[model samples]
Target chain A: MIILNILFAIAWMALNNAYTPVDFVAGLLFGFLVIIVSRRVLTREPLSLQSWFTFSARRNYPLLVWRWAAFIVFGFWSIVKANIVMARIVLSPQLRLQPGIIAIPLDITSEIGITILSNLITLTPGTVALDVSSDRKTLYLHAMDARDPDALRRETKQEFERRVMELLP
Target chain B: MSLLEIVTLALTALGVLFIFLSSVGLIRLPDVYTRVHASGKSATLGVVGVLLGVAVYYVDLRVALEMLALIVFFFITAPVAAHMLDRAAYLTGVKPVAGTAPDDLEGAYNRETRSLR
Candidate 1:
């Protein structure tokens, strides 16, 4: 299983198009280092393959496909919109910037889902996911031009969360 | 300059501005909690913006893929770090905002519950 994980890491790195012979060797060394470190640091009982694979498979596959589709569409649209807004901000003689942090309630429970949502928010033009509640129930997002907090929250809930939930099993 | 170069410059400028604002927010924001808000969130966007600008200028598949991976890795790690920091802060008794209402976690820890583990 550990070897598999190492191979999986290598494959992922390769897929990123950053892999070279040096990188592969470095990755293997890193993998070995991680093993040694985990042996010392993790005193807890070893996790079962079923647990690990199940967890990963449940969280990653089909969900990722749906999420990617949603992301491609939403991400392109958001980028174009963000470019326009940013252009306006840059070109305007008088900068009318209204930036604020608005707390957004998130319905997704999985850590993976929350991470995706937050990253998506950050990737979008003018918003950033500042902080989340201790329980991971609420996301605090900073918006570049947040004139209406409630509306932003509602839009986030509908556009991001709704799509994310649909993607998740 | 050509239209493409103009676009690239604009993106690069925006990216740099994001990085600057993030750094400022990191310094100016009150408290460790708020600083994390600024640093983690803004840094991710700043990096993404820069990468996007680079991708626009280069327009290569490999660069684009690498940028996508960086974005994914950043998104996954930032929240986990924030979660760890929040947990640490709570453990150290860092107070929330004054008007903050009852915390749901209090009950969970207080309960003489059966060991789910």
Candidate 2:
């Protein structure tokens, strides 16, 4: 489907005689619209065409790509904020802290999703996903400030876990 | 001197600050588990910021691509590395600092099968 999109984009460019990278990107967008409009026709064809970018048949590729890119950008922003928080903690005079390991029961079963979730947790400042249950139903993580584990759990379940499930499942 | 130069400098400085604080956390934090937070996350972020600054300053496609690749690689690997260190520390009985509690993972590890319960 991507190849088809690029081909369509190239054809559009050729027709318009607009050859800039920006124009190619615009052509790609137009090609995406074309693909969406022609998806049913494409799917009815033989196995060869259907096999191309197989996910496109079952899922909206544009939405998936958008979510993924949004997650990356948002994740980067969170890490920057986390660094500042860690910096404040480290630079502070008092070392008074309450730390503990908490288990977040896992709803995401895919190994890849679990892996990504754990890594995201690790990146978000204070939490490190130490391990998961053998049954793969729970994730064990260490929190730097375990003062409010309930709130933390609530936020994580609502935010990170849901997002991971969306990305993979 | 110029807007681009200023942005590059700011990014580089931010990266350096995070790296420095991570080092401080390494020295100040109580245990290995917590220390991993310092070393793993902030250091990676620092590297990311620095690389991004350089990429922005250079304004070359090749350089930007290389820097982006490095950043993505770091983002993927650093957390896994930290988790490994943490798991190793726990399995070896490197207990977390005092005041740690709710060991949900306790007794989950079996020596014979070497698998979590």
Number of the predicted model whose lDDT against the real structure is largest: 2
Residues B31-117, candidate 2: write the lDDT tens digits. 998899899888987998899999999988779889999998998999999999999998888988988876667787885666887
Per-residue lDDT of A156 in model 2: 84
Mind sharing the TM-score for model 1? 0.49
Model 2 over residues A30-146: C-alpha lDDT tens digits?
998987766656656444655445645235556666788889887887788778778888888998778888888888999999999998998886788898878888888999888
Off by over 4 Å in 1: A1-68, A71-160, B97-117
Error of 2 at A3 (Å): 6.3
Ten residues in sequence with the least summed lDDT for candidate 2 chain A: A49-58
Error of 1 at B15 (Å): 0.9
lDDT of each: 0.60, 0.85
TM-score of each: 0.49, 0.86
**For candidate 2, what is the DockQ?**
0.75
Write the residue-wise lDDT of candidate 1 on A1-169 in tens digits.
3464478559756766777656766766566555444532332434664443443433343345456676778855664465444444444566454555566667899887887787667555666565566667777665656677777888888877877666652
RMSD vs true structure, all candidates: 11.9, 4.7
Screening candidate 2 with a backbone cut-off below 3 angstroms (N, C-alpha, C), the clashing residue pairs are none
